[model samples]
Target: MPSDCTHEPTPATQGPKLLEERTIGGILVHFVAIPTGVAGAGIVYLLATNEFTKRNARNALDWHLTVLALTVVTFGSLFTYAEFTGQGVTDVATLPSPVSTIASVVIPTLLTLWFLVTFWTFFVGLIAMGKATFGTAWRYPLSPALVDRYGSELDFPSKWPFVIFVYVVLLPLVIWGVFFGSTDGAAFFLSAFGLLGLIMLLTPLTAVAMYLHGERDQSRNTDWKPHVAAFVGTPILIAAAGYVISRVFTESMYPPGDAMYVFLAAFWVSSIVYLVRWWMTASN
Candidate 1:
C-alpha cells in the first residue's frame, strides 16, 4: 500500500501537474505515512514536485522522523542500557555520571515530547489531508522547514528511510530477540550477528541526528552525498571488524566479557569512519 501510494507522486513530478495531481499526491503522502511511517513519507518527499504535495509530504516526513527517533529514545534506550550493564558486574552507580544523569533528564523530557508530537501530527496531518483535498496548504507546527530550506541545493537520496528504519527499529528488535535467553551454538551465531547489527545501527542513528542538528545550524553543508556514502560503506567495515574479533576470541562469542571489547572496538571503528566521511563531505 505504501509503495503503490508513493508511485502516484513520482509520476506527477515529471510533467506539468494539475491541481488534481497535487491534491491526490498530498493525500496519499499523509495517509501512507500513518502505516508506512517515516519511510513512506520520505519516498514521497524525494519524488513529488508540486508545491502542495512536496510541502505536506515534507511536513509529515519531518514529524514522523521525530516520532521514529523518539520511539528509540523512549522504548529502546533503557533496553540498550540494560543489555550492556547486564553483561558485567559493575553497579549502575559505577557507570559514568553522564550516563545516569542523561537518562534522568531524557526520560521526562521524552515523555512530554511524546504527547505533544503525537497529537500535533494527528491534528495537523488530518487538517493537511483535508485542506489538500481542497487545494489548500497546511504546514506543521514548529517545522524546521527542511524541504523549503535545504531542498533546492541538496539531492536527498530516497533510501534514507531504509537506512533509518533498520537502525532505528529493526536491529533493536532483532538484538532483543536473539539474546532472549540465548544458549550454545544458537547463542554463538546470534551473538555474532547481533554484535555486527548493533554496531551498524549506530551509523544510521548518527546520520539522522546529524541531519536534524544540521538543519538548525546554517554553517553545516547540506549535501546528502557523503551521508549516503558513509551508510553504504560502513556495513563492510562492521562485518570485517566482527570477523577479526570472532577469529581472535574463537570460543568467546558469549557476552558479558568475552565479546564486549570486540563490540566496542567495532563501534569505535564505525564512529571513526563516520566522522571521516562527515569531515570529507564538510558535513556538520
Candidate 2:
C-alpha cells in the first residue's frame, strides 16, 4: 500500500514535468537562435537529451543559416559599391559612398534588392518565432534541406484555429504601416513598442505560405465553438486593450500610430493564448 501510493504519484507528476520541460526546451532553442544565430542553436542541439528540443534546435539552426544566406545581399551591395569606387571595407554605420562614380543605376538598384531581402528575412523569422511561441510546429520557409532530414512528424494533432487572427487581422496591418501604404497613420505614432510597434506586422503572408506548404500546424479550423468564441473576442479585446493602454496608461489618448501598435501587440498575444488553449483542450 505504501509503495503503491508513492509510485502512483510519481507517474502522474513525471508526465507534467516532462511536458513542462519540452515546452521550455522548445522555447529556449528558438530564443537563443535569434541572437547568436546557428552557434546558439547548435549548442542546444548538442545538449538536448530529448527529441522535441533537438527538433526545435535543428530547425533554429537551419533558419539562422537561411537568414545568413539571405543577408549575403547586404554584402553584395557593399562589395559592388566598393568595387565601383575602388575602396576597401570601412565603417558601415557612417554611410560610406563609393570612391568612384559607378553607373547611376547600379548602387540604387543593389540597395533596393538588399532592403527587400532584409525585409523578407525579418518577416520569415518573425513568423517562425511566433510559431515556436504559440506551440505550433513550424518548419521555416526556404529553410535548408537539413531541417527535414531528421525531423519526425509527431502523432499529436497540431490544430489551432486562433492562428487565423494573425493572418486575418494583425500582420496585414503591420505591413501597411511599415510601407506607409495606407491612410491609417500607423507609420507615424510611437507607442510602447515604438519602433517595434511596427515589429508585430509583415509576417502573415509568409506564415500563410508556410501553412500552405505544410510547414506549419495542419489545423486552422475556425468553426469549433470555443475557437469561434475566441475569434470573436479577439478583435474586441485588441481594441479595448489599445484604448486602455492609451487612455489609462499613457498621459493622454494615444495617436493613431501608437494606438495601432498597442492593438497589434494585444492581438498577437491574445491570439497566441487562444491557440495554445485550444490546442490543450483538443489534445486532452
Candidate 3:
C-alpha cells in the first residue's frame, strides 16, 4: 500500500537498471532531518548517475523537505509562542493566571502532535524503504508528487544551500533560544522536552547524513558504538564529577537541580559536537 509505484522487474538491458532497494533502504534508514537526511539526499541526488537512482533520490529528498516544512510550521509556531509567553521554559507560577489555560492546553497538545509527526515520518520512511527493496518504488504518502511527475522542471540542487543554512545556522540559534530561555524548573522541563523533540527528529536525519557522507565506521558498519559512548558515557562521567565537586566543595549532596541541569547540559553539548562532526563528514 505504501509504494504505489513498484518498478516492474525487466531485463537489465531494457531501459534503466533497477536501483537496489538495500542501497535506498540504507539511505532512508539514516535520514534524520536537515543536517543529516536533507543534506544526504542532496549529496546522493547530485552524485547519482542513473535515471532510476536519481528518481529515488529525488523522491527521498522531496519527502524530507516536506516533513521539515510541516514540522517548522507546526512545532515552530508553538515553540515561538512558548518563548514569547515565558511559560514553557520558565516558572509557570510567574505567568499571569489567564495564560495558564493556554499553557495547559496548548503545550501538551503540541507535544503530542510533534511526537506523532516524528514517529509517523520515521515509521513510514522505514517501511517504505523495506518495501522498496522488494521491487517497489516507494514514495511517502504525505509527500507531494512534484519530483517524480515534474522531474525535468524542478531544479532541486538550487535548494541545497538553503537547506545547509537551516542546519548550520538557523537550527543552532533556535535550539539556543529553547535552552537558555528556559530559566525555571517548569521551563527547563518543558524546554528540555521541546529540545529533545528536535533531537529525536534529528536522529533519523543524521543517520542518513552519516551514511551518504561516508562517515560510517566501516569496521562496524554502524555508528552506534560511538553514539553510545558520547550520549551515555558523557552523562555518567559528568554526574560522577558533579558528585565529587558537591562533596568536596559544597559540603552537601549534589543538588538535584544542578544534577538535572548538568545532565541536560552534557547531553546537548555532546549532541552538538556529534552533529558537527557528522555534518563535516557529510559535507565533505
Candidate 4:
C-alpha cells in the first residue's frame, strides 16, 4: 500500500460547486437586456398613457411621456451607433461634422441629471403618500411650490409621482450606460441594472394590485383588476415585441450588428403601452 493516491473530493468542496451552479443559473436570465428594457418601458408607457387620456387626471402625463420618449431615442441611437461604428468618438471633428457632437453630449448629460431630480421628487412623494395613507400629518416637502403651480389636490394622494420617479431614475441611467460605456458596460450596467430597476418599480405595483384584489373581496371595487391585468400583460407583450423586432430587423434591415436598433424600437413601443395604461388608471 506504498503508493501515494489522490483522495476523492469532500462534500464541503462539492457544496460550493453546487452553489455556484445555482448562482450561474440565476444569472442567466439577466443576460437578455432588450426584453427587460421593453418590459420596464412597457409598464411606464401604459401608466402614462392612462393618465394622459383620463378626463380628470392632471397634466403630468404629457411631461412624463415626453421625457420617456426622449430617453429611449437617446439610448437607442447610442446602441445603434455602437453596434455599427464601435464605441467612443471615432471621428473628432471640431465643428459642423455630420455628428452634432455638442448636442449629443449635452442632451444625454442633461437628460440624465433631470431624471435623477425626477426620481428624487417621486421618492419624496411616495413617502408622503405613505404618511397620508397611515393618517400621519406629513405635508409634501415642495407642496407649496407644486400647489401654487398645479394645485395641491392634483399632485397629492396618488402614485403618479413615484411612477415618474422610477422613469427618471431608470431611463437616464440606461441612456448614460449605452452612450458612454463599453460592451461589458452595456451588457452588465445598462441592461442588467435597467432590469433590476424595473423589478424594483414593479414591486410597488404588484403590492398595489394585491391590496386592490384583497379590497375587492371586502368591497365591490373592481378598479384594481385592470391594473393587475395590465401588470401581467404588459411584460409579455414587450417580450413578444422584442422577439418580433429582432426577427424583422435582422431579416429586412441592416446587417447583424445593426439589429440592436430594432430591439430598441420594439421596446419603445412596449414602454408607450405601459405609460398609457398607468395614465388611464391613475386619473381621478
Candidate 5:
C-alpha cells in the first residue's frame, strides 16, 4: 500500500502532523499518488485544449507538462531499448548475462527514483503552503523556463488533444510493445502507468475540492470522508475496467499482457470522465 502523507492538516491549534501516520513510502502510496493521478488527467485535458498557452496560467501548466513529458520520454525510451535489445527476455533461471540483469533492474530503479523526486517536489510545496503562518506561497524552480515560450494569444481548447493522444498514441503504442515483448512487462507497465495516471487525476480533484469547500478553516474539524471515498473508489473502478477488458480480449480468459492494455485503456477513459465532470463543476 502507498503512503497517505498528503492529508490536509487539522485545526490550527494542533501542530502539523505528517499527512499519514505511516512512513514516507506509505504516504506516497496512499495520499500523494491519489491526487497526483487526478492531476495527471487534468494535465491531459489542458494539453488537449491548449490551455498551457495561456499567459497567466502558462508558467505553472508548462512546468507540470514538462515533468509529464520527461517522465514519458524517460520510461518509454528505456523500455523500448530493453525490448529491442532483448536484454532480459529469456528465462532468468537459465542464468542470463549480468548485463541483462543490470539493464532490467537499473531502468525501473531509475524510474522509481524519478517518481519519488517528482512526488516529493510537489508534495513538499503543497505542505509548505498548508503550514504557512501568513499567506500560502509555493514555488517551483523550473517554472520560468517552461512557460517562457508560450504567448497570450492561445486559448484553452475544448477538443482535449492530450486525452486523445493518450488513447490514440501513448496507450496503444505502449500496450502493443509490451504485449508483444513480455507478459510480465506488459502487466507491470500497465499497472504502473495506470496507477500513475490515476494519482495525477485524483490529486487535482482533491485540491479543487478543498479549495471550493473551504476545508482549510482552522477552527473547523477536518472531514476526510470525501477524500477517503475517492481514494478507494477510483482504483476499484480502474481494476474492474481492467478485468472487463481482460475478459473481452482473451475470450473470457485473462491474459496478463493483453489485460494490462485493456486496464490502462479503461483507466484512461475513467480519468477523462472524471476530468470532464470536475471541469464542469468547477466552471459552474
Candidate 6:
C-alpha cells in the first residue's frame, strides 16, 4: 500500500484572468480623481493600456470638456464680455435705464443658467463614474463623440500614438492652413492639396488594412452597407438639401460666406452617424 498523496493545479491550467485595468483607470478618472479635473482625466486616457479603459477615459474627457464649454458659454464669456465692455452691473441702482434693465433681467438669467449648468456637470459626472465602476459601456449625453468617431479605427496598438499625434499637432496645422493659407496662394494650394492627398491615401489604406487584420483576428462581422451609405450618402444628401434650400428659399439666407460652417456641420454629422453604426455592428 502507498501513502496518500496530494496534487495541486498549476497556474498554467487556470482559467482566463479577469481584465480590470480599463475599469480601474475609468474609476480613477471619473470618480476617484474628480477634483483633479480634466487634466487628470486626460492622463488616465493616455495611460490606459486597453481599449475598454481608453473608452471609459474618453467618456470622462468628453464629459469634462462639455462641462467646460457650458461654463465658458454661460458664465465665463458673459462675465468677461461685461468686464471688458464696462457693462458689468456693480451697482444696479446706479446704472442707467437701459443698462439697469439688462443687468436686472439678463444678469440674473445668465447666473441661473450658469448654476444649472454647473449642477448638471456634477450630476452627470457622478453618473459616468458609476457606469465606469461597473465596467459598462458609457456615453456622455450631449458630448461630441470625438474619440468614438475616430477611436474605432485605432484597434492596432502601434498606431495609437500616431493617431494622438495627428489630433494634437496635425489637426491644428490643417485648421490654420485652411483659415490663413489663402493669403499665400501658391503655398496654400500646395499645402492644402498635399495634405488632402495624404489624408485620402492614408484613409483608404488604413481602412483596408483594418478590415483584413480585424476580419482575421477579431472578426467583428460588420455589415459594409450602412457604413458605405453613411459615407457616400451624407454629403450628397446635405449638399442636395442645401442646394434646394438655396434655390427654393432665398440664396441670401444661406450665403456662400457660410459654406465653411455648412461643411463642418455636415462632416461632424456624417462622422457621428458612421461611428454609431460601426459601434452597433462591432458590439453585435
Cα RMSDs, all models: 15.0, 18.8, 12.8, 19.0, 16.1, 16.7
TM-score of each: 0.44, 0.35, 0.42, 0.29, 0.37, 0.39
Per-residue lDDT for 104 in model 1?
62
For residues 180-209, write the lDDT of model 4, one tens digit per residue. Answer: 655552354456546454444444344343
Error of 3 at 121 (Å): 2.7
Evaluated against the true structure, the overall lDDT of model 5 is 0.46
**123-204 per-residue lDDT for model 2 (tens digits):** 6556766676666547767677564664454222342243344444655564565555422222233222233423322223
The lDDT for every candidate, in the order shown, is 0.58, 0.53, 0.55, 0.42, 0.46, 0.55
Off by over 4 Å in 2: 1-21, 89-110, 113-126, 133-135, 147-284
Which ten contiguous residues of candidate 6 have the minimum total lDDT?
Answer: 202-211
Candidate 6 per-residue lDDT, tens place, 1-284, comes to 98688677556765433354335666656673355445556556655667777787888777776665665566554554454444443312343667655665775687787678666767777888777667764787877976667657765643522332333344346656777665342345545654563344333333333333333333345454344444535655676666666657875565443443354445445444554554576567
Q: After superposing candidate 3 on the true structure, give the runs of residues whose Cα lies further than 4 Å from its correct spot.
A: 1-35, 88-107, 146-284
Greater-TM-score candidate between 2 and 4: 2
Clashing pairs in 2: 85-100, 196-199
Candidate 5's residue-wise lDDT over 144-206, tens digit each?
A: 444455533333443232333344345545545544544554345755675455334533443
lDDT, residue 197, candidate 3: 43
Write the candidate numbers in order of decreasing TM-score: 1, 3, 6, 5, 2, 4
Against the true structure, candidate 1 reaches a TM-score of: 0.44
Judge candidate 6 at residue 221 and give its lDDT: 53
Full-model lDDT, candidate 2: 0.53
Find the candidate with the highest lDDT and give its number. 1
Off by over 4 Å in 5: 1-34, 37-63, 88-116, 127-133, 144-148, 151-182, 186-284
* 264 Cα displacement, candidate 1 (Å): 28
**Model 5 lDDT at residue 254:** 45
Q: How do these models rank on lDDT, best leading?
A: 1, 6, 3, 2, 5, 4
